[model samples]
Target: MSADRPELDRCSRCGECRAVCPVFRETRRETDVARGRLLRYRLARDAGRFSAADREAFSRCLLCGRCLEACKAQVDVPALMQIAKTDSGFAAGWPSLLTEKTLADDGRLDAAVRRYRSLSRWLGRATPDDSGLRLRFALPYLDAGRLYPKPPARGYLEQHTGRRASGVQKLAFFAGCGAGRLLTGVGEAVDRVLAELNLTAAIPEQACCGLAAWGIGATDAARRTAIAWVRSFAGEEYDAILSPCASCTAHLQTRLPQILAGTEFAADAARLAAKVEDFFAWLSRQDLCFDLAGLKVGAHVPCHARREVRDGAAFVSFLKKSGAELVKIDERLDAQCCGMGGSFGVLHPELSRRIGLPKVAALRAAGAAVLVTNCTGCLWQLRDLAARFDPALPVRHPVELLDR
Candidate 1:
């Protein structure tokens, strides 16, 4: 209920968030820090003053949850930030609103893909690399090379035409927007893994999970996207709905039901959210044997997934069962953000790269040849970092390595 009944009043500005906030650590700017942002919002909200600068400060955050975890006061920082991005604000900003509009309007999005690709090429940033290209812009902060990822020729859901998959355990695979659109191979890997376990998960048409909207503080857009997703699968039944993407898993399971509250779709949201579970937890529970073959892999836990799924214990258990030597970065266990906080990268690209690249550098420095995690968002980030920082190293989804 933090989104509706926000608890900015809880923050005493104790500054404990300074120690763990990924954005604060990177920027060290008072505006980028959680305490500072909360203080900024509190003063603005109390005075009935809102500005473009407040919107920038809010969008600058990674929404990684490290602040809330470290805060003694347990402030709902992102929730308070969302108040600025909601369209209810007197025209907060057009670009943020326009981006959310594009996300919510499916026809507009499908049409824009080609336009975006064309724009990228015209801007001299086009990359057609199939092996998880990390779009490094010509910005001074990024390593100077063009690596924009191309969408799959067809999406995963587009390829899988059947609704009734062959398995005793029926699952609805909610391929989050990235996997459904940009990283379609992740969906294929999930399919292969499911079939290897003698199970088939139906790939239903899904909208973007709306965390994108939430990250940028577009509350209404996030709500509309959530409702559309809930309505898309209204009549479908499944043992559980799974998305290999950790961000999607976390949002649908933890925050979505609350977002849908007081609406006709509230019950449906609650029902769908209840059926969602972490992909790794589900796999580890299946007790499948993984042949590690003496390979040691590095791991990074995404901020959103770390907060919502709590799968570190489960992932460790799965790794133990797999018999692989795990090289986990201690910072990830401390719940560090990967810095690809979705649109946070867009709002503050240099800061985003600064925060995320160090994590990847640490992994490679720690002698990891391959990095694995449950989040496609993290996968994209880690892969990009690998290409820029350690070209020979690779990043993968935990599911990608699970299948026989």
Candidate 2:
């Protein structure tokens, strides 16, 4: 539970982390791996040095927690590294800051997206090759006409508000900004599944889950977003608050409690954390049935779901009960990130693609026409990776698959 630099002293520097770290796996950079980064942070702390170059080394991480799970020492390198960055007053580069600033504000984010949509419209009409025209700055990511996700004028919160059912069991749905904004259909699919199961879902207005900003060293923006998120669902009466995105669920369940640890919002943060549940995990525990007759569905379990994998068994059990012919791709592939660390793809697209290629290959080899996961980021990454490597593959959420 401690993010202090001293906590990192637990690392024996055994090098087991290198085998598991996604960034290290790709770059083979010691500074990018957990053990190496922890050692670096410790040395910096001992020497009273927090230089910009040192900050970049710490910032160049996936924060994927692969190392934490792999390390026998069980050091929370991600948390420690993040906290160290915050303590040292390290800021993410201007690229991430400018994007985080726009996203940290709802109106600005919406307006920015509208501009991209307008450009997308113009390009789609202009020419077929227009999708790959020009412009590669990667802020809000309008790469030529190929908008990574087709952004709409209004997010899910602006479009839908309040409850959709009345039942003994109630839950608040944290319509994650990733899904609510870019993959709007994912939100619709979530709503459809909740209704189908006769579960009451109270849709609360929410800001960005802050994981994106947190992934970078943008602590101020992340903290502000977290406070706003807590404020939005403060008075809601629900048994649990569910997040359809694995990243959002992870942040809500893990980071929120830590961020508001000693603050006035401690109680509220703890309450939300207690109620927070991964959408698939919560849904899997529900008494619902589906008949996936003559279908071969594979799960591309996101890294957050893996890191918090206590829920994986139940999700598998639930899916088995649904009658779909389940084809688990590979244990390794199922447990890793889909190479989209939110802004990671935008910042280091080639590196992200390289990291995800194995996953793309594994899923393709599974031969399941439809691949399902609980992560919006993974969903987008998988879709992008599949399109690049294997166009025939279809990526979807388990809810969307179940709703079908």
Model 2: lDDT equals 0.70
Which 10-residue window in model 1 sums to the lowest lDDT? 139-148
TM-score of 2: 0.86
TM-score for each predicted model, relative to the true structure: 0.88, 0.86
Task: Write one digit per residue (lDDT tens) for candidate 2, span 1-404.
Answer: 12565566678889998887888887888887887787777777778767887776766666778887788988987778777667556644545434356655666666666676677564533312211222334334433322255455566766876545366777788877667766566778777777776766777655677787676667877877788788878876678887887778888888888877889888999987888887767877677778877767767667777776337435555666778777756676677777776655665677778888787787667767777777877776677676667666677777777777
lDDT of 1: 0.69
lDDT of 1 by residue, 208-249 (tens): 777777666667777888887787666787788877878888
- What candidate 1 gets wrong by more than 4 Å, as runs, is 1-6, 87-108, 117-146, 310-313, 332-334
- lDDT, model 2, position 263: 91
RMSD of each: 3.3, 3.7
lDDT of each: 0.69, 0.70
